[model samples]
Target: MRRHVAEFPDARVVLNMRSGSWALKLPFLQEVVGHSLRSIYLVRDPRAWIYLMLYNSKPSLYSLKNIPQHLSLIFKDDAVREGCPSVAPEFKTIQSVLSRSEANPALVLAHLWLAHTAAVLRVNEGLPEESYLQVRFEDVVNFPQETAETIHTFLGVPLSPAALNQLLFTTSTNLYNLMYEGDISPTNINMWRQNMPRKDIRLIEDVCGGVMKRLGYTRLAS
Candidate 1:
C-alpha cells in the first residue's frame, strides 16, 4: 500500500478482500496507512452467506475439508507475526470440530463463519468510527443507488449524478446474470428461504444464532 501510494500519490485505491484475508493483513496495513485508511465492511446474513458457500460452483475456503488448509495459510507464523490478533483459540475450535467423525458440512461452515467474523471484529474494534463503516449486502442489492451514495458519503468522496447513474447501470448489468432466469429483483435477499433445506437452516441458526441476532438478522427456522 505504501508503495502504491508512493507511486501514484493522487490515486484512490479500492481493495476488495474476504474477511479472513482482510483480518490477517489489517495490522500491517494500518502501520503503513495510519489514519488515511478507511474500511467498508460488507456483511451478509449468515444463513444466506452459508447457503452461497454450500451451493456456489466455486470451491470455498470454508468447506469442512478445506478450512484447515485455509486457516493454516492465514495463521502461519510469519503472517500472524505481522501484529494480527492471535486467533489460536478459534483455530483450535475449528480443528477440534473438524475432527469429529459426524461433523456435517453445514455445521463446520457455521463454525468457520464464527471464527472469520470474530477475527475481523477483533481487528476492527481498534479502528476509529470515521475509519470504518459496515454495509449490509442486502441493502446493496435491493437499493444500489442508495447504497452507492452511502458508501461514497462514508469515504468522503463525491457521487456525481452521472457517475451514480453509471454505477447503477453497471451493477444491474453484472447482477442480472446471477439472478434466476436473469430477472433483476431483491428476491435474492431471501433466496435461502426457498432453496436451503429446513434441517440446514435450523443447524446454521443453532450454531450462529447469537451473532446473527446481534447483526439484526432474524432467525426464520424454529
Candidate 2:
C-alpha cells in the first residue's frame, strides 16, 4: 500500500475478489493498509448464480454423478476452518445437507449459497455501517447509472461525467457485441427462469427461500 501510494498518491486502490469468505481476510488487510477499508458487497440472486454455475460447469462438472465429489472437495478445504473461524459451524450444516441421500445438484448448490451468504452476513454485523455497502446484482444490471453513482458515493469517489457516459453506453450495448458477437441477451437477470428446470427451481427455493425473501428475490415456486 505504501509503495502504491508513493507511486500514485491520488489513486485509490481497488481489489476485485469473488471469494465468499472475503471477510476473513479483512482484518489482516486493514492491518496492512493501516486503516479501515471501505467494502462493496455485491450479492447475486442464488437462482441466477446457480444457473450460471451449472452452465459453466459443463458436461463433466455438471453431471449428477460428479456433483457429490465436486462439492465434497470444495467443502473439505482445510483453509475454510483456518481462515474463518466464524464460518466453521456452517461446515457441518452444509455437509449434512450434502450427505442427504436424495439431495440433487440444485439443492446442494442452494445450501452452499446459503452457507456462504450467511457467513458473509454474520461478518458484516461487526463492520461499521459507513464502511460497508451491500448492492444487489439485479439492481446493478437493472439500474447501472444509479448503481454506479451509489457506489461512487459510498466510496467517496468522484463519478466523472465522461465515465458515467461510458458506463451508460456500455450498458445499452447488446451483450453479443460486448463479447465478440456471441449470441446472448443484453440483460440476463431472469434467464434462470427460462433455462432451469421447474424441479430444480423448486428445490433451490425450498432450501434458499428464507434468505431469498430477505434479499428481495421472489420465489417462483411454492
Candidate with the greatest lDDT versus the true structure: 1
Tell me how candidate 1 scores on lDDT. 0.71
- Report the lDDT tens digits of candidate 1 across residue range 78-142: 33546745554554577677667766778878887876676677766777778788888778777
In model 2, the clashing pairs are none
All candidates' TM-scores? 0.75, 0.75
The segments of candidate 2 whose C-alpha lies over 4 angstroms from its true place after superposition are 1-20, 27-36, 55-70, 74-87, 100-102, 176-186
RMSD of each: 4.3, 4.4
lDDT score for residue 119 of model 2 = 65
Model 2 vs. true fold: TM = 0.75
